[model samples]
Target: MPEEVIFESESDRSREEIAAYLRTVADNLESGEGITLKSDGDSLSLDPPTHSTFEVKAEREGPEGGPKELSVEFELEWPEDGETESESGELEIE
Candidate 1:
């Protein structure tokens, strides 16, 4: 299947700043409200179903003997029609 990005942002930010963004997302999810993303001239609002598949990944990219890049990503996925089913799994983050 092909994938399209509705909204995206990349930048350097302080830990505190990153926490703020994450908190906003968490709040919206908890409230069962639409999440809105806005940039200079781009904006989108999306509603996530009550339950969805959540994925977390930690990865490293770079050639051997070269500087390595590291990243952690969090994702939530659901159908466009706002329906979702979850697989069995347990996760914990520190």
Candidate 2:
């Protein structure tokens, strides 16, 4: 199955900023480089970072009866310096 990636930000930054940042991150991912950014209400999440991510809630028929919802969390870890690394909270998916 193809992996889906999505990005969401807290109710702080503007939509334009979030979109720009996501675009940059996507570019970096395409180049096989790790990206690190300080939390500013902006975040990104991906299923595999190779396919695509949707902002809308996705639903599927459950095997038993009801509907099933699939949610995922993603973290970004970037190398800072020699033996030093930085980590950030999971990107908001909602």
Candidate 3:
């Protein structure tokens, strides 16, 4: 499926800064409120269903004989209609 870019931001930040950003998102999710992302002139708001799909990924991208770039990504996805069904499972993050 084709995707449209919304508010996008990429920058080098300290671990504490990154954690603070994630905490903001977590707090919003706990409150069952929509998320509003704003960066400079770009802004977007998304209301995810309660049972959206949550995904975590780790990746390494590089050439065969070059330095490798490592990344970890967290994603939440759901249909546009705001209906979702998900199974519960144990997740441990540390």
Candidate 4:
């Protein structure tokens, strides 16, 4: 499937700032609310269904033994036309 970019923004931020943003999203999700993103007059709203796929990934990019970049990504995916979620093993983080 072709991927489409809706709204995106990236910038340097403190750990507390990042955590606050994540907490806001988590709160809305728990209360069954849609997420609305607004930046520079561009806005996007996303309302994920109850049953969706959640993915957590930890990755290291860049050349080996050189300057490396590490990242952790959290994603939620669900079918727009039809509902489907794949199963996976349990994930634990320390």
Counting clashing residue pairs in each candidate, in order, gives 0, 2, 0, 0
What tens digits encode model 3's per-residue C-alpha lDDT throughout 57-78? 8899999999999999999989
TM-score of 3: 0.91
List residue ranges in candidate 3 displaced over 4 A: none
Model 2 regions lying over 4 Å from their true place = 1-11, 40-94
Lowest summed-lDDT stretch of 10 residues in model 2?
A: 77-86
Candidate topping TM-score: 1
Q: What is the Å distance of residue 46 in model 1 from its true position?
A: 0.7
Candidate 2 TM-score to native = 0.33
lDDT of 2 at 68: 70
- Native-referenced Cα lDDT, model 4: 0.86
Once fitted onto the true fold, the runs of candidate 4 whose alpha carbons sit more than 4 angstroms away are 85-89
What is the model-wide C-alpha lDDT for candidate 3? 0.88
Candidates in descending lDDT order = 1, 3, 4, 2
lDDT of each: 0.92, 0.51, 0.88, 0.86
Task: Report the lDDT tens digits of candidate 4 across residue range 1-79.
Answer: 7899888988899999999989999999899998898878899998888767888989999987899998999998888
- In candidate 4, position 28 carries an lDDT of 91
lDDT of the structure predicted as candidate 2:
0.51
The sequence of per-residue lDDT tens digits that candidate 1 reaches over residues 1-94 is 9999879988899999999999999999999998999988899998888898899999999999999999999999998886777687999999
